[model samples]
Target: MKKILVVDDEFDILTTWRLILEMEGYEVTTASNGRVALESARANPPDLVITDWMMPHMDGVAFIRELAANDSLAQVPVILMSAAAHAPTLEHGNAQFRRKPLSIDDLLDLVKHKLGEA
Candidate 1:
């Protein structure tokens, strides 16, 4: 099973995503902020990372930069979500941007496509 790390500030969003991904047979791990997510990722590198753009302490962009700098985790695919009209530009090619208020089906489809599970 592919492991996925999900990072979001909202508790509800975190739990909801965990349940959804778990149901899809992915090993799901969640963190409330980018700081925690970074630690989690370093401890057990995930196949994919789904993160919120704005987060407390460390933002998604910073986290992605750190992840990219690390050789072991540099190749991990990342999906960044935001409520803003425009998503931030990422330097890494292994990253995807998605608008917030996302549909569960669409998110799942994107995850599947990124993980090559579709």
Candidate 2:
């Protein structure tokens, strides 16, 4: 199964995503803050990461920057989720952008596309 790390401060969003991904056959791990997300990634890197823009302690941009800077975790693909159109510029690699209020089909399509599946 593909592993996905979902980082978001909002419980409802996190829970909602976890359920959605789980139903899609993706192994989902969630973090409520960027700090925990970084730690979890370091401990057990996920194949894909979906993160919220605004977060406590560290933001999504900062988290990805740090992860990209690290050799061990730099290869992981990331998807940035936000209500705004602003997608952060990444140094290591590009990340997929998904806007807020995305439909289930849209989310699944993006996730599958990023995972290199049709």
Candidate 3:
């Protein structure tokens, strides 16, 4: 099964994503912030990372940079989401940006596409 790490400060969102992804047959791990997620990823890297742009402890941009710096985790694809209208330009090529309030079906489709199942 493909493993996916989902990071979001909001408990509800995190849980929702975890449950939905698991139902789709993906092994899912979740973290409240980028800091925790990075630590977990270092110990056991996931195939993909889905993160929220704004988070406490560490934000998405900083997290992506850290992830990219690590050779072990650098190749993992990332999906970044935010409610903010302005999206930051990502230096990483393996990441895709999406605005928030997306439906579960759309999210699943994106996840599949990111994982090269599209």
* Candidate number with greatest lDDT: 1
User: Where in model 3 is the C-alpha error above 4 Å?
Assistant: 116-118
lDDT by residue for model 2 (19-65), tens: 99998889999999889999999999998899998898998888988
Task: Give one clash count per candidate, in the order shown.
Answer: 0, 0, 0
Cα lDDT, all candidates: 0.92, 0.87, 0.91
lDDT of 1 by residue, 13-59 (tens): 99999999998899999998889999999999999999999999999
Off by over 4 Å in 2: 116-118
At residue 85, candidate 2 shows an lDDT of 64
Best first by TM-score, ranked: 1, 3, 2
- Runs of candidate 1 with Cα error greater than 4 angstroms are none
RMSD per model, one decimal: 1.2, 1.7, 1.4
Worst 10 residues of 2 by lDDT: 85-94
lDDT-best of 2 and 3: 3
The lDDT ranking, best first, is 1, 3, 2
Candidate 2 all-Cα RMSD:
1.7
Candidate 3, clashing residue pairs? none
- Tell me the lDDT of model 1 at 100: 92
